[model samples]
Target: MEWTLPQWGQLMTLFMIAIAMGMDAFSLGIGVGMRGILLRQAILVSITIGFFHTVMPLAGMVIGRVLGLFVEKIAVMVGGGLLIFLGVNMLYHARKQGEAGVLRDLASFWGIFLFSVSVSLDSLSAGLTLGLFEADTLLTMLLFGWMGMLMAGAGLLLGRRVGAWIGGYGEAVGGMILIGLGLRFLL
Candidate 1:
């Protein structure tokens, strides 16, 4: 079957959004990578992050679906507002310095779990907003999980070889992407 222009656009949008959501994972992975993680540990951590990214957004989408039932007319506005809020929050945190002890103990199960959840929180928010739209659920989730895993894995490996400066900038770029998307929704 052939695809239409709008379908292609939607696919691209979802793909970009998935990458944006993974930026946090990538940034944090860089931090962890800088600390010297084993390949095994990195793989495990990446899988965990991918799981959270998938689940969180799905949960958000469910909630969003419920909300859409009550406020169909204003759902778009609410979604846009949420996206903007999440983006600004990301930007704010990205500007902060001091990574001392922020990424310690990632070797522990609890530590890894907490870190994964924290990074995937934005995916939840993005999912909530997406719930308002006619987004393809399976495709979105797959993109998010896959990108989150790949990005995190890359970050961890790169962290060992690169400087810590990339983490903050990565988050900032992700924030900008989110903000731009939010504005697009509003307009």
Candidate 2:
């Protein structure tokens, strides 16, 4: 078994990447927190997203390794598609909100999990990219997950404050972000 530390420069690269990757989640988290979800619910949402951040990329890596040169676009397309769908769905729900909210309390764990998974689909695609570099999966996941947690925690706080002011429009914007990211990957 080989246990490797991330190269000092790779660690920096991953850290910056982590922040970039967390942008969507941060935006979504703001909306979630603004909806008046309890602290416990926010933590659950964070954990779910973090877990997906770890797993999706690992899965992508495994698949990419097997499929070799043929998998990047597939992973990217899948990831981008899912993000757009999630974002669009969020916007739709927001449009239906009563000017004050979109998502309700986070009592539904499965719902949270699925949302987390959808947003992190791009992370899987990113993981495939990382795998091509022979990066350490465990280290990579740890870096990604921690970055998500920090960003999400901040977003939850900020979203709670901002969501109330913007109402469901925040969610609608988040939806747009998802769609934009997906399109970006395609081009």
Worst 10 residues of 1 by lDDT: 96-105
Q: How many residue pairs clash in model 2? A: 1
For model 1, the superposed segments whose C-alpha errors exceed 4 Å read 99-101
lDDT string for model 1 (73-146, tens) is 99989988888888888788788734333555787999899988988989998998988885788888999999
Off by over 4 Å in 2: 1-6, 69-105, 163-187
lDDT of 1 at 85: 86
Clashing pairs in model 2, backbone N/Cα/C closer than 3 A: 30-159
- Deviation in angstroms for 96 in model 1? 1.1
Best by lDDT: 1
Model 2 agreement with the true structure over 25-95: per-residue lDDT tens digits: 67567767766667777788888788888788788667656664555457556555655665576677667
RMSD of each: 1.3, 6.2
Instruction: Assess the local accuracy of residue 187 in candidate 1 as a C-alpha lDDT between 0 and 100.
Output: 94
Q: The CA-based lDDT of model 1 is what?
A: 0.87
Compared with the true structure, the alpha-carbon lDDT of candidate 2 equals 0.66
